[model samples]
Target: MVVTVGLARLCRSVGRTASSLSVPHQAAAAGLPARTRFISTTPASNLQFKLDERTAHSSLDLFKKNTGIIYRMLGLDPSHVQNNPERFRDWAVVLGDERISGGRHYWEVTVKKSQEFRLGVADAQMSRHDCVGTCNTSWVFGYAQRKWFAMTNNKMVPVTLVGRPERVGLLLDYDAGLLSLVDIEKRQIAHAVKAQFKAPLCPAFGLWDGELLTHSGLEEPEGLK
Candidate 1:
């Protein structure tokens, strides 16, 4: 199901003053007062995509390599499994069902429950065996051990945040070749990067523990605009 929500509220102000006033005695002659008008409008809706149903056997099979991971209706969780050496060792990456080629798209992920999780986008055909952000096809912002970071092409950069964020936002502008990670409650950008994306992309995730819930079909946050 797609949930429609407005993430931005914009207000603009227009002002008009008698320009003649600055032209010497024209101010007294015009006898006009300065006026200001404020306008408020609802944010426009952005492109939205749906997450593939977890109940689908085919969908679950796509991540078979990611053992010990359980897919739920709205989220995914990792269950400790015995004798599973690969359990949470390799990246448990999941891709959204939608394929985005162009235009700007925005979404949010709830990471409060996951102590270690990855959020970002990956090329649709990227190897499932490769971890998100570790390969050239994906870019991701992650949180672990009370620290946050962004990674791509095996390179990781530490990002400083004011505090831990419960909900994180992702904005992908295909035309601009930009990907930004936002801290929802703080209305601030946690990290962002620019790239020459070459392939159709999908929202991707890597969950090592706990669970992650995603929110799509959201308007871009005003601060980022």
Candidate 2:
């Protein structure tokens, strides 16, 4: 289900400002203050993609390969896992089964408040030693040091948004070469990065300590079937 209830409430300022606006004639008569208006509209819910277990580096494996990270199975479904830690550290993982060469695909990730994380897609051959956005093999949107950034070639470009989102959506258009990272709670697109894909891309995740990162399973959206 779409996580809208809490988000709508968090973004009430946008709605309030939109409602307070007056038409041209009314503004002219009342001598009211008028300014350019911007309100965030909720986008359609489209998160749907299965998490591949075979492709994943489990908690124990992740810890073994990288001492700073931890992973755990959150629910009964083994495919659904979570990043569990009380503090922040560097870590990343890729889904084993799902690989997209072309067409449109999307997935949603739920993060705890005040947590640091990165979500994106990467080349199938991406290594555990490689950090997302530091190389051409991966593209990721991240929140850290109280700033939003898009990573490419290990470079960080600042991304400014009105507020923080608890749930972020990743929309991939492989054929069109578009990768959009969206704020699900605010219902706004945060950033859209484009790259020519020469290799198969798979879902990639990274997390540090401070909060949980749950892998919500995918379901086919209507009409896509």
Best by TM-score: 1
Candidate models: Cα lDDT each? 0.56, 0.49
- Separate clash counts for every candidate: 0, 6
Extract clashing residue pairs from model 1: none
Tens digits of lDDT, candidate 1, 75-185: 333342232221222345666766677777788876545666678887766654466666667777767677776666655566675357577788877766778777788
The reply for model 2, stretches above 4 Å from the true place, is 1-91, 211-225
Superposed by TM-score, candidate 1 places the C-alpha of residue 145 at a distance from the truth, in angstroms, of 1.4
TM per prediction:
0.64, 0.57
Q: Which tens-of-lDDT digit does each residue in 73-111 have in candidate 2?
A: 331243344532211122335442355666666667665
Worst 10 residues of 1 by lDDT: 20-29
RMSD of each: 20.1, 17.7
